[model samples]
Each structure stands twice: as structure tokens, then as C-alpha cells.
Target: MKKVYTAIDDFKKQGLDMEIPLKLLMFTGLRNHSLSLLKVGDINWIEEIIVYNAGIDNSKHKVQFLPIPPGLMAALKRYIEENNLKFNDNLCYGIKGIPLQNKQLNRITDKICWDIVNQRTFNFI
Candidate 1:
């Protein structure tokens, strides 16, 4: 966990755009699929929970509200404000302001893990 976090920090320091989304996955333990589909409106500012609507056919729960820790919530709020995101806007998007694909999110995880295992830098770009 520590190594993975270190890699993520490196990514952030290098100014990669997926920092927040990576942190969200770490903090919330949400799958890449769910994280990819997350929207600004899915976050409940008052309740401090993320409203996850799992639309998969085999999903056990169609809807779930995941609690957000104070630290993460604050960071998320800042990210939203900095990006000028609207309610309908995707929480995590690319430089083009398009929602990140599931493959991209998975690549983040893979890069971190590879770096940790190989003891070397892994570039996300």
C-alpha cells in the first residue's frame, strides 16, 4: 500500500490529471468501471456520501451510497471547483474534458503496481 501510494504521489507531482480519480479509487475502494462513470451529481455534499448507481445486470445492489471521508471530500470539492464542474459533469475526465474510459483508469492501477514491483518509474503518458 505504501509503495502504491508513493507511486501515485509521483504521478501527482508529475502533474498527471488522474490524481484525484486514483485517490478516489484508493479511498472508496470503488471499481474502475464505477469510478469512470461517476458524475458530479453523484456526490451528495450534504450527506457526505457518493450515490453509486450500479447499472450492471448482475449487480447485487442497483444503488449504493458510499460514505466519503472528510479529507477526501475536501479534495474532491476542490477538484470540482478548480475544474468548474457542473452537476452533470463527469467527476474524472481527460484533458479534452471527456469522461475517462475504464481502460484508462485500469492503466493507472497497472502502472502503480508495475512501478512498485519493478522498482522503477512508470509513465502514464
Candidate 2:
């Protein structure tokens, strides 16, 4: 957990665009696939909860909602505004504004953990 926090701090320090999604994953306890599936409409500002829909996946899924922490919610608002996201726009994206794939998210996290383990960046992944 400490390492995860450290990785997040490092991502923030480096001004990585992935910081928000990483924080969301940590705070919401959402699976990588679920987090990657998140869209602007999933967030309920009035209720401060994220609506999770498993239908987006290629498998049987459950619908659920998770409360968003106040601080995270604020950050999310700022992120949405900064990105000019629409109701259906994905919350986390990659190059060309494409929604981030689960593999991409996993690779970034794996790279961060690799860096933490080795105390250096692993560019060869």
C-alpha cells in the first residue's frame, strides 16, 4: 500500500495524466477493467457516487455504485473541466483521447512497481 501511494506521488510529481485514474483505482477499489470502463455519466455529482456497469465488459457483470471521497470528487471535477469531457466521454484516456485499455493501465502500474522494486526506472518493459 505504501508503495502504491509512493507510485501515485511520483506520478503526480511527474505531472502524468494518469494520476487521477490511479487515484480513482486506489480510492474506489475498482478493478482495472472497471476503472478503464468509467465514463463521465458514471459519476453522480448529487450523490457523490460512481455508478459501475458491468455490461460494458464481455462477460456477466453486476451493477453497483461506490461513494467518491470529497477530495477525490473535487479532483474529478477539476479533471472533467480541464478535459472538457462530455457525459459519455471516458474519464481516463490515452494518446489521441482514446479510452485507456486495461493492458495500458496494467503496464503503467507494473512499470511503477518495477521502478519501486529496483529503485530505478525500467524502460525496457
Candidate 3:
């Protein structure tokens, strides 16, 4: 399980500067599909909340509200400022493209978590 502390440590070590989404997912325990549909507007930084506006195309649920911790919110704000993230229409664009599709995002996230778990297990051996 990618909990807060582990996620934060991994974020720091990755140095890829794409830690906000990872932190959000780890902290909130959101489904990857729900996360994929998130826009910058969905986040209420002042109130420390993330509104899951709706589920992705194939998902069942429509919407949900997730509480954002101060630490996670702060990190997200910093990431936006550092990256100059612009809110385009209803999307948050990153690096090379618009927000990723659920499958792509899930694969990336799963790889990170798997790597962390594997490394920890190896170290304990």
C-alpha cells in the first residue's frame, strides 16, 4: 500500500516533478479511473478538498468528495507553481499531454508502487 509517508519519500527520490497526482492518489485512496478525470478546478486548495467531479467513461459512480490534507495540498500548490500548470478549459495539462487516460496512469502508478515494495522486500532479505 502506497501510504502518505512512503509516497512522499518516493516522490522526493523520483525527482521527476510529477508527484502531485501520486500523492493525491496515495493519500486519498481514490480509484485510478476517478483520478484520471480530475481537473485543476476540482481541487479547492483553500478548503483542502478534491471533488471527484465524475467517474471515467467506463466507471460506475458519478462523483465524490475527497479531503485533502494540508501537506498534500501544499505539495500540489508547489507543484503547480513550479510547473506553471495552466488550467485549460476543464483539464490540467502535464509535460507532454493532457491528463492521461486511466490505463496509462494506472500502469505508471502500479510500477512505482511495485518497485517500492520489491525494493523493500529485497532489502529485508
Query: TM-score for every candidate vs. truth?
Result: 0.85, 0.81, 0.66
1 versus 3: better TM-score goes to: 1
* Model number with the top TM-score: 1
Query: Which 10 consecutive residues of model 3 have the lowest summed lDDT?
Result: 88-97
lDDT per residue (tens digit) for residues 1-125 in model 2 = 67766766666566556667778888888988888889999999999999998775555667888998999899899989998999999888752357888888888877878787888743422
| Model 1, runs deviating above 4 Å | 55-59, 94-97
* Model 3 agreement with the true structure over 17-92: per-residue lDDT tens digits: 3466566667777866666667777887777898876635656665677898888788777767776766643233
Each model's lDDT:
0.80, 0.80, 0.61
Which ranges of candidate 3 are over 4 A from the true structure?
1-15, 55-62, 89-98, 120-125
Instruction: Give the Å error, residue 85, model 3.
Output: 2.0
- Clash tally, candidates in order: 0, 0, 0
Q: Model 1: which residue pairs collide? A: none
TM-score of 3: 0.66
Scored by lDDT, model 1 comes in at 0.80
> Ten consecutive residues with minimal summed lDDT in candidate 1?
92-101
lDDT of 1 by residue, 1-125 (tens): 67766776776677766667877888788888888889999999999999998766665757878899888899899999998999989898753457888887776777778777888875665
lDDT of 2 at 84: 92
